[model samples]
Target: MAPEPYTIPITVRGYETDSQGHLNQAVYLQYAEHARWTYLQHGGIRQSDLLDKGIGPVALEVTVRYLRELRAGDETEVDCRFVWGEGKTFRIEQQIRRTDGTVAAEVTGVGGLLDLQARKLVADPREYFRALADDPAVFGL
Candidate 1:
């Protein structure tokens, strides 16, 4: 069975809306990025830890699908799940849902851990994450 996704709540702010009063397209990516970082933090993995280990996370590709529109003051929950497979990369799947249970958007990404010195993707990123995380199970390790 798949593990539960990490989730964080967010409120749409007026400044983040477009002239049409809907959430700006670019902001959705920000929301997704926020969720990903929060997930890492929740697992006790901090940005400094990764950097100290001479590595950093890199997003190779991202795809966003807009569904229902979001407006200022709307409360939403963003959930992030990491799917690990064989090799140097992993998949991140996220969903932004309004309080009413409507899905506003879905973001999918391909990411990897890069060796800062080598400037190349790591052979097994999970090893690095497992070494740094307080509870590797949070990432389904």
Candidate 2:
């Protein structure tokens, strides 16, 4: 069976909205990024842990699909799932949904773990992630 996706609740803040009172297009990326970091924390991997190992996560590309407008005070849930593939890169799939289960936006990102010192993508990102996570299975490792 596939592991459950990691999720977190987020409330649209007034400052995040645009002049028209809807969420700003750029804010969608921020929401997706927050979800990804939270997911890593849920798996017991902290940013400090990666820094200690001289490795960090990098996003090579991202695409956002806007479905519904989000206004301030809107309560939403953001979910993140990791799709592992061959080589050094992986796919991150995410969705932002309203309280009533309406999908407001979807985000897809191509990412990789980088070797900070070498300034290059790592050969085996899964191995690095597995070593850092308290429960590797939670991240589909």
Candidate 3:
């Protein structure tokens, strides 16, 4: 079975808007990152834990699709879930939806664990991520 999506509520702030009074494209990435971090933390993986292990998460690629515009003061929810992959590489899908039920943005990203010292991808991923994926076979566990 696939892992269930995790969602967090968000509200657009004044500073996050662009000249047109809509959410800036860059902020969408930040929102996705925030949701990912929150999800990881909830799964028992913290930034310090990764640093202590000399590993850091790195995104290989990301594709974001803008569907609806989000204006300042709009209430939204960001949802994320893991799409398992081989080795240490995995994918994640995230969506930001307005309170009215319209999708504001959708992001699909490929990422992996990096060996900070070696400056290379880590073949053996940490257990926290494996648990997050909820599919041991995908990570060869």
Pairs in clash, predicted candidate 1: none
lDDT of each: 0.96, 0.95, 0.84
* lDDT score of residue 30 within candidate 1: 99
Candidate 3 structure quality by residue, lDDT tens digits, 70-121? 9999999998877766577788899999978999999999998898999998
Clash count per candidate: 0, 0, 0
**Where's the lowest-lDDT run of ten residues in candidate 1?**
1-10
Per-model root-mean-square deviation over C-alphas: 0.6, 0.7, 3.2
Give me the overall lDDT of model 3: 0.84
Error of 3 at 139 (Å): 12
The digit string of per-residue lDDT tens for model 2 on 1-141 reads 558889999999999999999999999999999999999999999999999999999999999999999999999999999999989999999999998999999999999999999999999899999999999988888
TM-score of each: 0.98, 0.98, 0.88
* Highest lDDT against the true fold, candidate: 1
In candidate 3, stretches whose alpha carbon ends up further than 4 angstroms from where it belongs are 126-128, 131-141
Q: Between candidates 2 and 3, name the one with more favorable lDDT.
A: 2
Residue 11 in model 2: lDDT: 99
lDDT tens readout by residue for model 1, 41-139: 999999999999999999999999999999999999999999999899999999999988899999999999999999999999999989999999999
